[model samples]
Target chain A: MDITDNKENMTEAPVLLSVRGLVKSFDGKTVLDGIDLDVRQGEVVVIVGPSGCGKSTLLRCINALEPIQGGEVLLDGQKIEKDGKNLTAIRQKIGMVFQSYDLFPHLTVLDNITLAPQKVQKRPRREAEEEAISLLKRVGLEGKAGSYPRELSGGQKQRVAIVRALILHPEVMLFDEVTAALDPEMVREVLDVILQLARQGRTMLIVTHEMQFARAIADRVIFLDEGHVLEDLPPERFFTEPGTERAKNFLHMFEFEAVR
Target chain B: MPDLGLNVLLKGKNMQRLLSGLWTAMRISLIAVAISMPLGILLGVLMTKKNPVVRAVLRVYLEFIRIMPQMVLLFLVFFGTTGAFGWNLSGELSSIIVFSLWGTAEMSDLVRGALISIPKHQYESSEALGLSRSQTFAYVIIPQTVRRLIPLSINLITRMIKTTSLVLMIGVVEVLKVAQQIIEANRMASPNAAFGIYLTVFLLYFIVCWPISMLARRLEKKWKD
Candidate 1:
């Protein structure tokens, strides 16, 4: 449980992404109220909580995928605004992988991966395709270039979704339960890809339902409850010695999950 | 071996007139399709906008077109316009105008349905990838929408083609008109000319529409897989 090495590293690294007093609402009902967070460079922070705790909304607000009622998300000290002049540029720097993979059904795996780099980044087609093919190879999808999304397995599609976001070379990644939709047997493959990404020192903010996976990959674990951060600590500390009574009860809900 | 009373089709010049008449029907639908496709696409895009006036106007246009029969619209454009405006419009030209307006409305509705049918996540995924609104439309939204639209639009085309028989009411000598002419002229020579020639006309329509609906079904089946 000794994570002092990680703690020392966290203090020295600059904050790569931060949310400041973020407030979000839907139809006048508050979902995330006065939420603040900081994710350092080369860090992986996982957010977990009971359903409707606003973890997904927080990630979406970071990506500006949802309209925020108040406050801001910043990357590399620059504010990420929904209507900023350079919003698209800022959006490209914050990659997101969704629960459903959301691959374009009409596009081949290669096209899905290479689209943004070629279209938005204006990278050369040859270069983009070469990189995408190699990345596809790295994700163990060696020769699926021409296969459509419908042709791939859920795990394979999720891996392709990761590559789709990664090809843009974002500063940080936001994963909203990427494996939640995968078949149980397939979930390991997608999680393994994410674990490898963490080993390579990618800054990521993840929302996941897999408690064990969250504990294993996260440098920091944030427990959200009732529209605010209830606990933020090193996974070692938070898992072992969760601060609030709420956190303990939340942990208890997962204790009875039977392994099949 | 009777050819189902289809002997009327082979009579001197009757077959040629039917083919030419079929061509007349095609000309109206084809021109309408060509003109309506782009405008329909634009109007369909406009329909997605949340502006009150745009929604109200498009809704009114759609209801007007759907409630009023095409024959009534044809009458309005062909006879009513000519009588009121004192503009001499040929029957064929009048048919073309009426069909074009009808096709535009149908095409636009198809486009709107296709556009809205696209899942919201597709738009989100595109935007999250740094695609601008226009880029998302061109790269993601439009491609997916068009895929959904093709089968439906082909079905629409088939319907419009068959409905061209209505143009005869406006005095355009399309296929139905030609069939009537042939049946009338053969009344003395062939007792069953009405049944035979009308059957031939029905076969002609079947030949044109069958392949289109088949293509549409094939497309839908392919997408499902």
Candidate 2:
């Protein structure tokens, strides 16, 4: 099978995020090694890997949630370390949707969505609420604005999480297996919202177990094994003709009938 | 002595003094709890930091507070501090200071335990949501900690109130102290008054502590359900 590279370096397609020569280790166990990646505007990049392959750590490093042992991360052409910008400012422009949908138990769904904007951004309450309501509507959770997290279904909670992230109007969204904790029947609803976001040209970095969604939505797919990117190709080639034997083997592990 | 009727007891000056002592004990307890709760929470957060040195220091502090009896702590703060430092402190102030210090350490340890007991995944999930550190603590971590801390803190409050009697040893003149004084005054006139006065002090402590104990239980049930 022929390798397909979907990376397009349009002059207008400025690099919105970049990671170069990234390395990290925990207790002398190297989890990421000499990695480089670039995410352009409006691109959806999906990372797939076997368990313990450092995909999550790589995503965490880009967000600056996990400290990087070496190398640099640039957001929107600005060097994160050299600029001395606070993580909060950088994080404000990056939304994250987690598999567990970590909604605040003390807050109503609307409060969860509006909290950071109202508190951190200092937006007026009415204006924040208005934006939150609209975002809630976008995620099909308008009815859940006043409900506590415990009152919502798992799917509804994840959708609320999406709206919560979107409320910040982030330039990039990171999804870490957002469907992993959902019931099988509820997975499609959350994935549908993600697919819609991708369609609207949101730059997304997804560390996902959902191969089908990755195939359908990713502009570029990266397969990782043993802390290294085994294959960086378009979905067609990534699924059909993975470059390294490690990628092939990693993909095979998910083929267990029970995993479906 | 046997048939001291309710009407007679209510009209007696002794009952009034006993009531005053009860009020004073309640005041001391409330003030101590109010002062200690926030300090406890701050120390609790500090205890959970990633630094082993900090954790070890906090652990030592917690064990020292836990192992030493409260009565001994009171003596150290009240008698020892005053004697050693030559600080002129009032009895009420000294009592509040000692209890607050003791309670703060205990409550802080409880808060630390509750905060650490939460699944690490909760924080990871919050981080995955791109929450700022403060947002992660305020929204995700603190709310959960508050629920767990409430019942335990109330338990501490109840313990504090009941233990305020220990302050009478240092002569703060709370309920138990008042009871001893009244018994002493009436010892020649009424032989059994000592037993009666001691019983009354016991009842006052029970009345003050029982409601708080019940509230803690109820909070546990509500959170569990």
Of the candidates shown, which would achieve the greatest DockQ relative to the real structure? 1
On TM-score, the candidate that comes out on top is 1
Looking at model 1, residue B56 earns an lDDT score of 89
- Score residue B19 of candidate 1 by CA lDDT: 91
- Candidate 1 on A1-260: residue-level lDDT in tens? 23234446677899999899999999999999999999999889999999899999999999988889898888888888888888899988989999999999988999999889999999999999999999998899978999999999999999999999999999899999898888999999999999888877889999999999889888989999879999999888888899999999998988877688
Query: Residue A196 of candidate 1: its Cα lDDT?
Result: 83
Q: Which stretches of candidate 2 lie over 4 Å from their true place?
A: A1-12, A256-260, B1-12, B49-57, B74-94, B114-148, B170-172, B180-199, B210-225
| TM-scores of chain B, in order | 0.94, 0.90
How well does candidate 1 reproduce the true complex, by DockQ? 0.76
Model 1 gets an lDDT of: 0.89
Give the TM-score of chain A in candidate 1: 0.95
Going through the candidates in the order shown, the clash numbers are: 0, 0
Residues A1-260 of candidate 2: C-alpha lDDT, one tens digit per residue: 11113335523688899999999899889999988898888888999998788988887787776787889988887665522556667777888877788777767888878877876677899999999888888888888789988899999999998888888888999888889988999999999898888877789999999998888888889887788877889888998888888888777876777665
lDDT of 2 by residue, B1-225 (tens): 573222323435979888898888888888999988999888888898898998898788888878988889877877898789998777788889878888889998899899997777677656544456687888778888888889999999998898888888777888888878777766666656766677777888888788889999998877751
Model 2 - which docking category? acceptable
Give every collision pair in model 2: none
